[model samples]
Target: MYIVGLSCYFHDASACVIRDGDIIAAAQEERFSRIKHDPKFPEKALTYCLQESKITLKEVDQIVFYDRLDQKRYRILDTYTSFAPLGKTMLWNAIRKWCGPSNPENDLYHSINTLSKKDGKIFYPHEIEFVDHHFSHAASAFFPSPYMESAILTIDGVGEYATTSYGQGKDNHVTLERQINFPNSLGLLYSAFTAYLGFRVNSGEYKVMGLAPYGSPTFQDRITEHIISWNPDGTYRLNSEYFNFFATEQITSSKFHKLFGGPPRKRESKITPKECDIAASIQAVTEEAILRLATYVREATNQKNLCLAGGVALNCVANSKLLRKKTFDHIWVQPAAGDAGGALGAALGFYYHYQKNERKISMNPYDSMKGCALGPSFSNEEIEIFLRKQGYPFERLSDRELFSKVSDLLVHEKVIGWFSGRMEFGPRALGHRSIIADPRSKKMQSLLNLKIKYRESFRPFAPSVLAERAGDYFELRTDSPYMLFVAQVASKHRIPVTEEAQKAQGIDAVKLQRSTIPAVTHVDYSARIQTVHKDTNSRYYHLIKTFEEKTDCAVLINTSFNVRGEPIVCTIQDAYRCFMRTEMDVFVLENYLLRKENQPVLFEDET
Candidate 1:
């Protein structure tokens, strides 16, 4: 039986198809729409899933949505009523958008109906299941994980009425035991600080995490004292006086700005020491809270393994801190831990819970995520045809030749756009859709940021290290295939900085080389790692291994293959456009390679 899962009408809208409990395909709407964080119904993504799985919409046995519209509507009405008068305008806007004739439920049904029509035949779904938002998250984390049973934790911005939830998953069953409701969310709290620090809310939270290590936690005390009320049971409530999330579109209130010593920083404004300190303070607080929560989850569930899903689960720094504490013997985080993974969870939840299927775990590859390489892929013939049609210069090479050529380019400090196999399913690029470079270069970090990415100079890149050699370069305890865990550079690979460099604060500190792989190392001597496993992605593993053979270093700088303000490249055309737009030296589409010098000038450049 085929099951179709969908999450839409919120950021990172996505779709997935599963056959007999195995994921066939998954992708985000932003990838095909070419719009960052597209929230509309994922028609294109759903279509791609159907095509990739060689099935039509009629073949799908069940269609499950990530959240129940009734629950979300109730939550919205309740919150707006509670904050009445203060949120009158916002409440009206919400009511008009969600409760009007064209509500989410209606739109969703219409979209499904429209997409199902083919050759004058119409077939509606046999069953439509709407799950609790956080339950979807928990199922996504636990069902795809390698554990037979595990404690589950899901934390994110408001999902219906829930903001945070914890439960246990055993076999094919999951039970959410307790939850922290909306209006007091850690995700929203972090997003408020993200906005205050001059970044987009949901998308820019990681930017805040990247900036934290530049400064001391000078404002940590103030934040803990005035913004959040702590509890002994590992739950906390946000102080409403400093937040405007309940009543207005704005995340922070005037009182919050007053406490922070200023108004929100304008986008693209210069980074000040204050912003850096605020980032550090909030990061510290978040890590502490997460550690406490993990402790509580462990004690309550008494489970040896833990599965995590939610936007906050993407914070590598906090994840690393939790790993160090070892509150659980093992932890498995969904690659697409945010709402995108909700689609996958919705399908799996219904399949296991309603259908009563027995659970099966894949031990050889650690988990059933298949390295999160579940997106669309292209053949060499298709790539060649496009290249020829576009009149772009290119050359085809064998696997050995390609790996050797790419490795040599990296050693020579040439940045290469690597596109191979399926695109990654999550926000992370992994290796399939990555911009790869030599991690050893001291100037590479600044070069890639300013010249290639065209973004903040201090944002650190992650390293794709051979799984076996991961411990040789970084102090990691387990595999981090999705680049979701930050670990320190091994002591042997770390270099001492000058006292003057040590004294420098904020962005200036980025100039210091802290490790042998300086380009991927952050100011705190940490690196977000993606351990390349040969079984899951032999080609990527071989590329890194070949580089290691030549340079005696097993790590390669791996970052999403798009510049600032764009989703990662999806199609070959998207890859080509980004290659021409950026200063990357080489572009690899499958076995074909195109050098920057050989390519024609961009269309804009021609005009």
Candidate 2:
């Protein structure tokens, strides 16, 4: 049986199709829409899934929505009603969103029918299955994991009434034991700080994570004292006085600004020491909360393994702390841990739990994400046709020749846009849609940020290392295929900072080279790592391995294949446009390589 799952009307709108127990296709709408975090109905993504699965909409046995609309409506009403006159504006907006002409709850059937109309054929499922939001998150975590039974934790901003849920999965069944309700969310608290620190909420939390190590956690006590009330059982309540999420669209309120000693930093403004300290303080608090929660889950479920999902699970720094503490014997995190993966989770939950289908674990140790290489792929013939039509210069080489050539370019410090195979399903680029460079260059990080990514200079790049050689370079001893965990650079690779460098504060400290792989290493001597497995992405694996053979270092700096505020490049045209837009030296589309100097100058109005 074929099942289709969808999550939309929220950030990272996505669709996933599963056959029997296998995920056939999954992608976010932003990839096709060219809008970062497109929150509209995922018609294009759903169509792509159907096309990739080689099935028509009529052939899909079931359709599932990630969260129940009624539940969300109730939560919105309850919160807005309590906040009343003060929240009049927010209340009207909520009502308009739900009762408006474009309401998702009212138009899902129409949207689905409209998209499936090919050759004038239109079909809708008998009934749409609505799963609980947190349940979808939990299922997304437990079902795809390589665990027969494992503790489950799902934490995010408000999902219906639940902010956090924890339990366990055994066999095909997942049990959510307890929950923390909305208005007391750790995710919201972090996002509040993200906005206050001159970043976008939901999108900029990771920026705060990246900036944390530049300053001390001097305000951690202040944050704990004024913002949250903690319980010994790892449960906590937000003070709520400092927040305006319920009363207004803004996340933080006047009280929050007063406590912080000022209003939020202006967006795109220069970083200040205050903002860095705020980031460090919140990061420290978030890590402590997550550690406490993981400890509680380990004690309660007594499960040797743990599966984490939801937005908070995206915090690699917090995830690293969880790993170092060894709260569980093993941990698995969904690559699309945010709302995008909720689509997958919803489908898996309905299949294994609701439909009573038997579960089959894959022989692959990487679980069932298929290395997240589940998006659309272009064959060499199609790419060649495009290159020829555009009159772009290119050359095709065998895999061996291309790998050797790319490795040689990296040795000469040439930044390359490497687009290969299928695009990734999650926010992370992985190797399939990555801009790669030599990690050993001290200047590569800033160069990529300013000239290539056209974003903040302090944002650190990730390291894609051979899976077998991961521990040789970093302290990680296990797989991190999703780049979801941060590990300290091994002591052997770390460099001692000079006295002057040590004294540098805040963003200035980013200039210090803390490790041999300076481009990928953060100011804290930690690196977000993606372990490339030969079994998963052999081409990328061989490329890195070949580079390692030449340089005697097994790591390559990998960042998403896009500029600031854009989704990762999804097509050859997107990749080519990005290559030409940036200061990149080379572009690789499968076996074809085109140097910037060989390409004609692209005019802004040409397209």
Candidate 3:
């Protein structure tokens, strides 16, 4: 049976298709729409999934939406009614307008209905089902995890009425034991702090994480004393009065500013030591909360393994802390742990819960995701056809030759746009769609960000190392196939470059250095690593291996294949458009390669 899952309305709108228990294709709508964090109906993504699976609406046995609209409506009503004496009619009306029939959720139903109407002659009605948002998040993490039975935890911004949930999954059955409702959300608490720190709430949380390491935790006691009452049992209640997410137009009210002793900082403004310290303090609190929650889940469920999902699960730093705590013997976090993964989870939940399918655990960590390469892919023939139609110069090489050439280019310090196999399903580029540079080149990080990425200079690039050699370069022992862990660079390899040398040199000088690759290395001398195993992604492994053979370094710089503020490339056109717009030296789409000089100037002006 075919199951189509969808998550929309909220940010990171996406679609996932599954045949039986195996995922066929999954992608975020932002990639195709060229909008960052697009919260639309994901029509392009759904269309791509259907095309990639060679199926139609008639073939799909079930359509599962990630959340129940009625459940969400209930929460809105309940909250508003509770505050009726305080007068919240305006907020209620605004919410009603937002959830009108023309909104994203209604549009999704309309699209499916339209498609089903055309296929009505062949299929039956009432095929669509709505899964609980938190349940979908739980399933997305637990179902694909390499565990027969595991404790499940899902935490995110308010979903329906739940903000956090704890459950246990054994075989095909999942039992939700407890849930923390809205107005008492850890996610919202963090988002409030994120806003107060002068960052975009949902999107800029990572910046806070990155900045945390730079300061001391001076405000930990203050936060625990005034803002939240964290419990030792891993459950906590927000003070609520200082937060305005529920009642006010802003995330933080004037009372919050008074409690915190200042107004929210302005974005792109100078970062003060106080801001850094606050970031550190909040991050520490968040990590402690996750650890406590994991411990409670483990004790309550008596499960040795754990599965994690939700927007908060995307915090790699918190994940590292959880791993270090060893609360659960093994932990598997969904790659797309945010709302996008909700789509995949919805499908899996529908299969196991509604369809009564038995859950199967494939314990091989290498096979947990089929490399998460479940997005669009173009064959060499298709790429060649596109290049010819665009009148671009290109070459088609055999697998061996292609690897050798790309390896040679990397050794020469030429940044290459590598688009091969299917696109990755999550927010990361796991070799399929990536910008590859020589990790040894100290200037590579700056060059790519300034010329190609056009983003902040402080952001660090990641390293894609051969799986077997990952330990040799990074102080990490576990497999990081998804680039989810930040591991320190081995001390023996971190030679300090002088301030003068750092200031005077460019890519050329950095390339000749026998010391630190300062560009990719963070201030902590660590890199977020993606380990590539030949069995998981043979082509990508071979390409890295080829580079290794030439430079004797088993690692290469790998960043998402997109410019700043854009989603990673999903289609051939997306890749080509990105390649043409950037200052990248080469474009390697499948087995075909194109040079910058031979391509048309796709961007009107090179800003």
**lDDT per residue as tens, model 1, 316-418:** 8898899889999998999899999999999999898778898788765679898899999999999998998888999999999999999999999999999
Candidate 3 achieves a global lDDT of: 0.83
Local accuracy of candidate 2 as per-residue lDDT tens digits, 60-94: 88899999888888888888778877788777777
The C-alpha TM-scores of every prediction are: 0.98, 0.98, 0.92
lDDT of 3 at 548: 84
lDDT of 3 by residue, 378-448 (tens): 88888888878877789999999999999998888899999999899988899999999987876787798
Which portions of model 1 show Cα errors greater than 4 Å? 99-101, 119-126, 604-607
What is the lDDT of every predicted structure here? 0.92, 0.92, 0.83
Clash pairs, candidate 3, are none
Per model, how many backbone clashes are there? Answer: 0, 0, 0
- Candidate with better TM-score, 1 vs 3: 1
| Model 1 root-mean-square deviation | 1.5
